[model samples]
Target: MTRLHRRQALRLIAGATGATLATPAIIRAQTPSELKIGGMLPLSGPAAIEGHQVLKGLEFAVKEANAAGGALDREIVLMVEDDEANTTRGVIAVRKLIETDKVPFIVGTYASAVVIATMQITKEYGVPLLSGGSTSVAATDANEPGNPWFFRSWPSSVDQGLDTANAITGRFGAKTVAIIHDSGSYGYSLGDQVEQVVKDNGGEILSRDTYNAGEQDFTTLLTRIRSEKPDAVYIGGWAGDGAMIVRQATEVGLRTQFVGSGSMVSDDFIELAGPASEGFAVATLYEPSTPNVYGAEFGKRFEAEVGQAAGTLNSLGFDSTSIGIEAVRRTGGTDSKAVRDMIATGLADFPIVQGPEGATAAFDAKGSVDFPNFIAVIKDGVRTLA
Candidate 1:
């Protein structure tokens, strides 16, 4: 079934008392024995590279939490599933985690489309879900009321869109631009926001186009964009696809400046695009090169555990899991209702791990974190703060 249809069905099955029903006597009775946390991620699909990085960060966080004496004096157990970046698979993975594993709190699914689709299952089971990487604005839109079980650890695309637009026009002095996206929910929503920001900032959108995720060839789209001869091109997609577009744009002689959203900051993009990635600009949240106390500490811990420097996905994963653990501790137990209430009502003042930006993470009423946005450029195939 389609993602929308499945969400509708799940919502119907949940009915009005889904929240109360989800808190079974068995769950409350078993909370004292073990504190189980569930997670879902792409793991084996188009977004797997990003998903795996996020999972590693979560694993490291769980390890740290356990070493620090665990939450509420109970050992924490993390269970994960592979969503494969597919909505149907995401539904199944989340269901198994919520029902079969009986985890009260879950984290995961890097792709915004997967998060959007599987969130219904969390609502049905009354499990709180903390987004590890998804950045679509719709993920926490206040208009869609009733589900308070959702929260985001990263800044929304709205922040990235506004940052990119301002950087393109204010810094680069671009008057017109062409846009391309992945045609998935994340890319499309971010692209739409950037398009509006462009217009609002006294710039013209020369052309707009989209490509499906995992598509390699972009000659036709690049040729069409080249004809418009915009001052720059804005890309709203993941690293793999964005890298291909940059390489092909070079081969086709599309000479416009390329600016991208946060997803373009991955090492995958730099490795795939090689020399073509130079001079590419992106609006992102975390810049490892920027010296900060939190980044330094997190970098050391992450390198010790995963043997690599931390990136955006890794930082987000660590922060989200840390926040969830703090909420559980504050509530004094693993009751889903109590944890959810703490997150919604007292998350703003909760003392947790600082974000990569070296600021204490605070959540607005919408469950979105307020963090700084940064502009970076690819210099010698490496992303450096601009």
Candidate 2:
């Protein structure tokens, strides 16, 4: 075949020969001497412990990519910002990451509220954001415009709520469930979804209680819940507050099954309340050991790296980081929009940590993991999947 010396032929090959065919400059820019993937996680206040877990996941991905010859022949860079678990701060942090740091991609913000705020920023800039955190109905429920560039690394509350309800009522069959929340969108929204699932499944909610996130004492709610004496409790809140609720409820002699949302599966929750964390279960997207999967190996690697069992955040971070790097490579450059599209349609059955085990799905259209999640239980302060 004769080499195409025409402009139309070149344009057809690269799809818009605008700035693309500027090969030398494109390659030089593609392998950015300083390519930074921004990270925004709550590093202060109640959710600080989770920030470290998610950060470790990001670091591990960066290290792995760099060791394996990096993406697009460029070294990895990380620009981190703390959202403090506040929505306003989270949006601002992401804006800085976009305009100031000039990071083409981002991953972070554990709180759904914080991620929602950052979503506005990423949408404005058209960057591909793969969050190691953030799971709310509002975050991915884009029936109208949709979050075109927003991809989540965890399962949504809708999935978890429906699944948890099925696991509780359909599989184990919870009779009477008491729903609890911490007054944020995270707790209340998820609690509401779970409550509907239980009610739909013929289980009655004995009582629904709401508390402030930072409040250490939940004696009043615990007292009321203990009085009702439900068969099980569906707890919702940040890791810190959720831990407190469990400890207080256990102290007040509430012998109900304490089931928490995704946030409750973190090491922070267990470490904060110690023995009080026993008997609590959390529904989350990733499991440390589930046959031949990256979740188990990532958990092992993280344990070696951090000297402890990986939390929900750690498990998710590994998946998100690996997916993000691969997306960049598959797209063949650091174009944010291409990577975002790759994340959307490109992650259908793609595997991560693929030496011995199989692949891990990064994101589906709904911005979910598109994979099975385990119902992890805390028995004697150790996390084991049920």
Top candidate, metric TM-score = 1
TM-score of each model, paired residue for residue: 0.88, 0.86
RMSD (CA, Å), each prediction = 6.5, 9.6
> What are the clashing pairs of model 2?
351-359
Prediction-by-prediction clash tally: 0, 1
| Candidate 2 structure, TM-score to reference | 0.86
Put down candidate 2 lDDT per residue, 1-386, tens digits, no spaces: 11122112100011234664332111213234656777888888677877877788788878878989887787888888998998778877887777677666788777877777667557656676777577786877641233466676545676677777666775556798888888888787888888888888788888888888889888888898888878888888888888888888778887778888887777778888788888788886555665546556766877787787666677667667778788888998777778778887777666743212444454544565543446878888777768
- lDDT to native, each model: 0.76, 0.71
Residue 370 of model 2: what lDDT? 40
RMSD of 2: 9.6
lDDT of 1: 0.76
Q: After superposition, how far is residue 188 of candidate 2 from its true place, in Å?
A: 1.6
lDDT of 1 by residue, 1-386 (tens): 01111111100013246346553232543466567888888888788877887888789889999999888898888899999998888888887777678776888768887888877667666778888788887878831443366788556787778778888877888999999998888888888888888888899998888889899889988988888999999999878899899999999899978998787776777888899999999876665665556666776777787877676777777877887888888888777877777776666654333334335545555666655467889898677888
After the best TM-score superposition of candidate 2, give how far the Cα of residue 160 lies from its true spot, in angstroms.
0.9
